[model samples]
Target: MLVTPLTKLLGIRVPVVQGGMQWVGLPPLVAAVSNGGGLGILTALTQPNPEALRQAIRETHKLTSKPFGVNITLLPTINPPDYEGYARAAIEEGVRIFETAGNSPGKLIRYFKQNGCIVIHKCTTIRHAKSAIRLGVDVVSVDGFECAGHPGEEDIGGLVLLARAAQELNIPYIASGGVADGRGLAAVLALGAAGANMGTRFMCTVEAPIHQNIKEKIVASNEQDTVHIFRTLHNTARVFKNKVSTEVVAIERKPGGAKFEDVRELVSGARGKQVYETGDPDYGIWSAGVSVGLIKDIPTCEELLARMEKEAEDVIDGLVKVRVEKAKL
Candidate 1:
């Protein structure tokens, strides 16, 4: 059986994790991943309020008796949801695993630990990972520049970033961004990561709640089909290369950079939700990673995970054979 620090920590059979994807991490997909022998995460803020989040968690529990997690991304907004309330609800609902992103959880990390929850913080830079470690997170999920959504301001790819993490991190950590197949899983494991956290790959799965058209677009698009917006604003986001995203880039390139207001209407979260619900890929700006190129079909979560596990086994065995030949030389 494939196993690692992550598998042991999360009590799962495989080391694959479906990272939280906003608007996509509903119960259907989350439960599927957990049932398939991987960790699945539900997006907290995707619910309207803390109460809604509690219901979502309960619903996921009904779907799968296996372990699943909740993702509560702390973004800086004018009016924020009750972060503490959300944590309390998850704790009350018996959720023991959490994936936090965007901003640091600060004292909430302490609260979660106190409540017997395993905290996994997602970050893009080694410095940020160190900070989370100091803050007492059980695990760190490091994202590379090839990741969707916010990859931070650093442009480090998984190859160098993960190797660097292997060298520096003290606790168990996972590799996020651009990992779509078993080869990617084998690569990260070789680089010293405990597991692989996949967002785009999960999004393209049959169990993912997004529309099939969006999945098809991802399968058809290549690595270069993604463009980064808000680079000038210092909060760059990787999104699918569509008409709306291209226009956002065009506006960002012209003059002294684009303001949030300049493209606010175009990048609306509601519109992105419509794209997912309506199956119109070009209807709005949606997030996707460079791993889109690696996706070719929409398979069930179980099928996908089983294939990845076999592929990883084969790759590792092939590498061992290569090492044996080298030793003979």
Candidate 2:
């Protein structure tokens, strides 16, 4: 088995992590990933309230005894959900791992650490990763420009981003973006990431809990099938290239550019949730990473992870052979 700091830290057998996706990170998917030897995460805000999140946690416990996590995204909202209450709910329910994203994790970090939780903060830039480290995050999930959802303002892809993180950061980190296969996993490992955190890839799994049509849409799409919306508002989000998303981009590029208010309805969470339930690919703006180009089939989490492990091993072995041959000259 390929062991890394991430595996050791999370007590997982593989270095694959299913990233927390809104609407998609439910119990089935999360439990499947954890049972398949990767760390799975539920999106806390996906629950309607702290009580709802607590119930979700309890339900997940019924599904798998393996390690899983909850993602608590802290964003600047007019009426924010009770972030502390959600944290308390997770802690009370015996969740030992957490994935925090959006805004500064300063306030939440202290409580999570105090509870003996292993915090993995997602960052779009090395600077932000450094700040998270100072806040006592145990690990960093470095997101690249190729990631879905909010990839921050920086446009660095995993190539330069992961390498830069390896050069500067002292703690263990995982690569989050454009990772779909064993080759991608091996590449990230070579670039100094302890593992690869995949959102788009996991979305195509059998237990993803989304409509089959959506999974088929992802399989049929190439890397270029994605577009970035809300770039003008400076909270650029990478989403699938569909009618709704295309229109959102057009509206953003209008005369004086646009604000969040202008495109709010188009990118509403409700609409995105409908796309998954109704199986309509173009019904709304849905997040997807460039890794969509690499997904060819919707395999079970067990099947996918097994294949990835073999593929990563083969790739590493091939690299070693190449180096040995070159050294003989």
Candidate 3:
């Protein structure tokens, strides 16, 4: 019943698109979100390599026939994976929705457009969003400072950020950062967003392939449960606050300790993957949005999306009643 530009663009019933959480965006979770009537995005880099990503796509296809996407974050690294090879693999698997983030998506944008794919480039600043619009992206997933993963250095919250996006840009955007529940969905729609992109909240779902201990940890957390690491390096990331992350932050505060090598072990992605596999919440750098505090139960993707949709409708209906009626003046 709730429709928006995002829903139509993505050909999904709900305007919700699961944020592709790294190491956690597995096939089971992606397929569940798709089967639940929303677009699910697989994390391309989560696979070992391009060939592994192709196999992951094939695995997802076996679970559900619904449309899904792949998240290809084009960030710079010492040895970057072949981003183009991953895109080609996704295309070969019939994936038309592409979520591109990090670095400039210029080359990837052109390739996706040429292939008639809908590319949603996530950006933290309005300038980048405008640049992406000019660069031929289909939609912009506006990530505010409250988001998990790379929240950019701007540190602007979603409330102000979404308004800025609505004011300055012509393209439709989905609100990210701190968005988790039906009220958040309703709030974003009122603030002129097409929809929302959620990360932490989805991690607390049954479909999420992470350990149950991790899911419960997210559920037990509140807004204060997240801490920002990598700020010392100026490539800030929001992660679940824990012994490891806390230690990382403490080290960053020490004199001459802001270098990457100083806290590399605590924030290593390799260690983070072990945390996911072993269900140790304090093992390594694990990302979570402030919305983690809002998660109270671990529901299935279908149950969560269905309830969120109903709640959004209820809120929107309430808003519709706020119109002016004839009054004696």
Candidate 4:
């Protein structure tokens, strides 16, 4: 495969990026993705403290010599959560890449650049992508409505979002959301994106730290199985359809009966931790992209990458063959 600016900037062999999934991007998982030829990312906030994040970075370094990154989500509600401290710690640990999500990165982007780390901020809309570019980020990871986590209220899909970003932004960017296979990858590339950032797809990989049961659930899911909840909070998350999420939606729709605090218990962060770690799907939160339906089997990071590359090559070649046949006519 031809190396793009994304691979060159990150110093990785492939353009694919392992999305920083909370509770899933541990040291072993991050190292595995890096070793498998993609830019692995550790979710920094998953660590209980800044010291724990430092330790995870050290462990990832011990596992692979390849490049990797750390993701820090700037949630505004957390009062003085020491986000800058975490960013400084990641820099001191020699992390070459940083993926920022959530609220405005603002000064954090300047800080990362000053520390000699390339910043890639995940944005759900073209406006946010422009903001990241204005903040001087090297790359942008555009997460469309089909992505897991907070897909924003605009609900724009990847194809339209990527094209819009390409038209408006000068900086190199990657397409995310609803991308899980080689065809998805080729489609993103053809859409003018430098590469694809995969979250749910990587979650099903063997290297992912989530329980095997969760991986199985992801594989078994179809496009119709996901539901977006918490829109009343102005924070929408795409979760696999379950009893809990269904109830959440139900409560939100009730006339003069639903309260944000009422559904808060069901969407607690601790509950998500339990579900992701213990595989107790019934009691905790399970995030999945609409692309989960397309996933049929669980594969190792290596196998997934190899298969995606081969299938993408076949797709590109097939397109060329069609063009050649047309010329003969």
Candidate 5:
């Protein structure tokens, strides 16, 4: 297979990027992904402070010399104490890739670029992708409606969004959302994407820090097991079907339904942190994409990569045979 711009830019053998999922994208998981020939991402906020992030980076380096990235979600709730300090620390740690989400980094993008980091901002819409490209980001991860963790209100799928981005921008982009296996990877490549960014799929990996209960739940799920909630607040998120999510949807459907603030309290970030770490599903919110249903087992990152490559090659070979038969006919 031909290497895409994403592989070239990230200096990875495979174009797959393990999404910077909170609680999940830690040093162990990140190192596993990178060692498996894919780009592993460390969630910057997973650490308590910049020094912690730097320490985690060092640890990941010790595990694998492969290239990796860091994700820093630009959200309002983040403590404003040392956001820039964290960025600087990551740069000093020799982290070359930075992934931003939630809001535009704007000037922060420039600062990272100045420090020799290749920025790849995640956006759910074409407009946002354009803005990132204009800001001189090396690449963009176009997250579609199927993605977890705040998949914008536009509800655009990767197919339409990637086409739009490819037509409008000259920069390379990877398709995120609804991507789980090699078939999904090949599909995105067919849709004009260079590669795919995966979150839920990586969560099912053995290296992920989530509890076994959570991993098992993902393996048993299907496409219909996901639902989008909090649309009223303009912060729609695709999550697994759980007691909390069911309640959120039930409330949303009721006449004169509860206010966003009310539900917001029920699904607080602190609560989510606990559920994700402890596997107490009913305790709080758990952000997951519909792709969770497609995941079947908790394979190691290396195993997953090998399977994906084999499957992708087989799929491509089958397609080539079909074309040859059609020509003969």
Candidate 6:
């Protein structure tokens, strides 16, 4: 078995955690991952209110008795929802796991801990990881530049980031960004991570609520099919290459440069949600990681996670045999 600190901590059989993609972390997908022995996550702000989130949690419970988490990314939104209310709603529903990202997890950390919830904070740099550790977060999810969402300004890849984090971090961390299949999971284990956390990889799953055309687009994409936008704003996001995204990039690269308002309409969350519904890859800005290149087929979460687990075992067995052969020589 491929056991790690994450598996023990979350009480999950597999160490994998699905990314909390906005508009994509519906109950069906989350429950599927949980039922498949991995940790599924519900995006908090996806619901219109705390009551709606409560219903979603209850719905997920109906599907799987396994553990799942609610992700509440505390970012700067034009009209922010009641973030704490959503967290409390989940807490009241007996949810024990919390995945927090963006600006600061300071306030929510205290509440989560007081309620005996396990907090896994996502960070793109070593300093932020250290900060999360200092704040007593139970786990850290280290995201690299290849991550679909905000990858921070440093732009370091998973190999360098995960290796460095493994050497320095006293707490256990999982590798995020550019992870897709069992090979990626095995690579992260070698780099000292407990497991792999995938966003773009999960986007191609059969259970993903997004349109099938979007999944097909992801499968068709290569590594170079993604582009980095909002770099000038220092809030860099890696997304699939599409017409709207291309326009945003063009505006950002203008001679005089562009402002936040310049691309606000083109990159709004509503537009992205529409893209998810319509299956039009070129409709709006949507996050996709470099790992989209690694996706070749759409499988049910059960099939995907199970295959990865078997492949991980095979990889470890192969390595052990090689070591034995070398020792004999």
- What is the C-alpha lDDT profile of model 6 across 1-329, one tens digit per residue? 78899999998988899989999999999999999989999998889899999999999999999999999999787787798899999999989999999877888888999999999999999999999988889999999988998999998999999999987899999999988988889889989999889888888999999999999998888889999999888888888889998999999999988999999999998999998899888889999998988999999999999999988888877887876444564
Ten residues in sequence with the least summed lDDT for candidate 5: 320-329
How high is each candidate's TM-score?
Answer: 0.98, 0.98, 0.98, 0.96, 0.95, 0.97
lDDT of 2 by residue, 1-329 (tens): 89999999999999998999999999999999999999999999988899998999898999999999999999888898899999999999999999999996899999999999999999999999999999999999999999999898879988999999999999999999999999999999999999999999999999998999999999999989999987888888999999999999999889998888888888898999999999999889899999999999999998999999999999999998876444564
Q: Lowest summed lDDT over 10 consecutive residues: which window, candidate 4?
A: 320-329
Clash pairs detected, candidate 5: 221-293, 222-293
Between which residue pairs do clashes occur in model 6?
Answer: none
Question: What is the lDDT ranking, best to worst?
Answer: 2, 1, 6, 3, 4, 5
For candidate 4, write residues 1-329 as lDDT tens digits: 74788888888877899998888889888888888888899999999888899999999999999999999998858475789888888988998799999886888998988877799999998898888999989999999999998888898988789989878989899988988998888888888888889999998988888888888988877899999998876788998888889999999888875677898899888998888878877776778899998999999998898888878778877777766443564
lDDT of 3 at 144: 91
TM-score of 6: 0.97
lDDT of each: 0.93, 0.94, 0.91, 0.87, 0.85, 0.92
How accurate locally is residue 241 in candidate 3, as Cα lDDT from 0 to 100? 91
Q: Report the C-alpha displacement of residue 292, candidate 5, in angstroms.
A: 1.5
Cα lDDT tens digits, model 1, 17-113, are 8988889999999999999999999999889999999999999999999999999899889998898998999999999999998775877888888
Which whole-number lDDT from 0 to 100 does residue 36 have in model 3? 93
Candidate 3, number of clashes: 0
lDDT of 4 at 132: 92
Q: Which sections of candidate 5 miss by over 4 Å?
A: 78-81, 325-329
Prediction 5 TM-score vs. true: 0.95
Error of 6 at 14 (Å): 1.3
